[model samples]
Target: MSELIPAQQLRYSAQLLLPEMDERQQQRLFASKVLIIGLGGLGSVVASYLAGAGVGQLLLADDDRVSLSNLPRQLLYSSAEVGLHKVDCAKARLTAQNPEIAISTLPKRLTLAELQVLLPEVDLVLDCTDNASSRLAINQACYTQQVPLISGAATGWQGQLLALKPWLGQGCYQCLYPDWQDSPSCLQSGILGPLVGMVACQQALLALQYLLNIGVIPFGHLRYFDGLQGTSGQLQLQQDPDCPVCALNE
Candidate 1:
């Protein structure tokens, strides 16, 4: 950990002013590494905030290309980038946002084995994928590596968030959705832009808190946000006795 340069101090002065944040915490954020899967609506917001906040290293993975339909919420891409790979576009945008941090791009979906290999190097992970298969795979890998995970989803007028600390043995994502079934994606169900951003911001906020050791983040709890009503609620999660993914950990 090196001292914060004058430029960095000025750039992050707002954060340093917080009682929970100081030069040491700011340096921790600068040295931390985060892996984010999916570059959709949620991924877009999470990646942008983490980058802007000065996360030292970011691993971005998404195989999809930017599409015109994505503009509504995937703010990382533009009309000119509609056919470009999302990871590439995201890398460019995030790098341009903060040239100090390092960014790595994986332009394809990762298999469980791939995630297992990658998770060990990451300090934390953000599961921003929209499907059950991707989310389950990420959860399994994070649990195996004993890394913290922040998972989020949004579709139609609803959004969900979870911060899972696997080593705590509280509960894993599989425990919440034992069947590993996912609802229709935003593509089919239609999503409001702000609805997804709300969840993404929560996901990013939890990540920052976890990394900086600040505030009481609700790990192992499911947070639900109703876009239409503009209200949110939370439910504590419990590990299932029969949850194959996390049962062996107990």
Candidate 2:
């Protein structure tokens, strides 16, 4: 690992102070690469936190352009950026926030094949996409590549997060939502802005923990949040014996 320069040490001084995150762990963060799929509500927060913490490289993928509706939850983009590609706008904002980290942008949605191609280059993947189909595709790619996945979603006043390490014989996103069908999205069902922010922040925290190998990994479990009630719960997940995506790994 490359030594932390004086500026980096000062930038991450608070994190370096944590017993579990010292100079060595800070260096690990600086050397890490993260791929964030979807530059929406969840992706925006995940990208901001990760970039601010000095993740070495960030690959942002999102084909959608910023819209008036996205300004509420997707905090990375401004009103002036409306109609601009989300990845490009996010790249500009995140770059300004942390000029030291390398920021790469994919101004389009990724096919499963593209995800497979990119997964190998990153240490972790964050599924910040809002749709089930996208999440499932991301899970499959992560499982195939044996990369850790931090998945999160929010709809209406609720959200859920799960970390999957299928290579560890754990249940993947598909195992949790087998026989999935199209579900109501934020556009149709409506969403609470803070709710998405909270969930995305949790995803960011889980990503950091997974990357640094600190704390208990939340794999094989789901964390659900209810913004209306302001409460949360956990569900332990089990691998399906017949799960197509993860059974082979087992």
Candidate 3:
């Protein structure tokens, strides 16, 4: 890896100040490649923070277009971009935020085969998508590739975040939701705008910690945030003996 230039060092001075972060870890972040699925509320926050923090390469995938209603929680797009594709809008915003980092986009929803192909190229996967089907597909792809996954969801006053290190025989998203039925989304259930941000921030922190090897990876555990009560809790997740996706790996 190349040494950080004077400008780069100054750009990331805050993160570099941490005892767990140094030139080496900064370089690791700069060399890391992350694939983020979804460009809605959670995806917007996760992409913005990771790009701002200097994650080397980001591959954004989302087929949805920006809607006027999305402006409340999806922070990346402006009113003028209402009709544009989300991945395109996200790419533009993230690039403008950090020109030094490489940003790529797949403007269409990825099929499972496509995800499998892309998984091997990325160091980590962020399942920022809202629906159950997308999340299940992302999990299966990550499990097959043995890549780390940071999954997050927020609806109404509640939010959930989980990090899965599938290679370690840790529980995966499927272990938590065995039935792949469509669940209520923010659109139907009505979401708290700040709740998405809170979950996304946690997801970004987990991704950074995993990439930089800074702290415990939180595998097989879920963090729940209650926006209404202003409290948080953790749930110890266990690998399912019958999890179709991960049981074979274990």
lDDT of all the models against the reference? 0.92, 0.89, 0.90
Candidate 1, superposed: residue stretches over 4 Å from native: 248-250
Full candidate order by lDDT, most accurate first: 1, 3, 2
Clashing pairs in 2: none
lDDT for residue 195 in candidate 2, whole number 0-100: 90
The residue pairs that clash in candidate 1, if any, are: none
Q: Which has the greatest TM-score?
A: 1
- Across residues 19-97, which tens digit of lDDT does each residue of candidate 2 receive? 8988888778878999999999999999999999888899999989999999989999999999989999999999999
Candidate 3 per-residue C-alpha lDDT over 16-55 given as tens digits, one digit per residue, 9 for 90 to 100: 9999999999999999999999989999999999999999
Query: How does model 2 score by TM-score?
Result: 0.96
Worst lDDT run of 10 residues, candidate 3, spans 165-174
Candidate 3 residue pairs that clash:
none
User: On TM-score, who's better, 1 or 3?
Assistant: 1
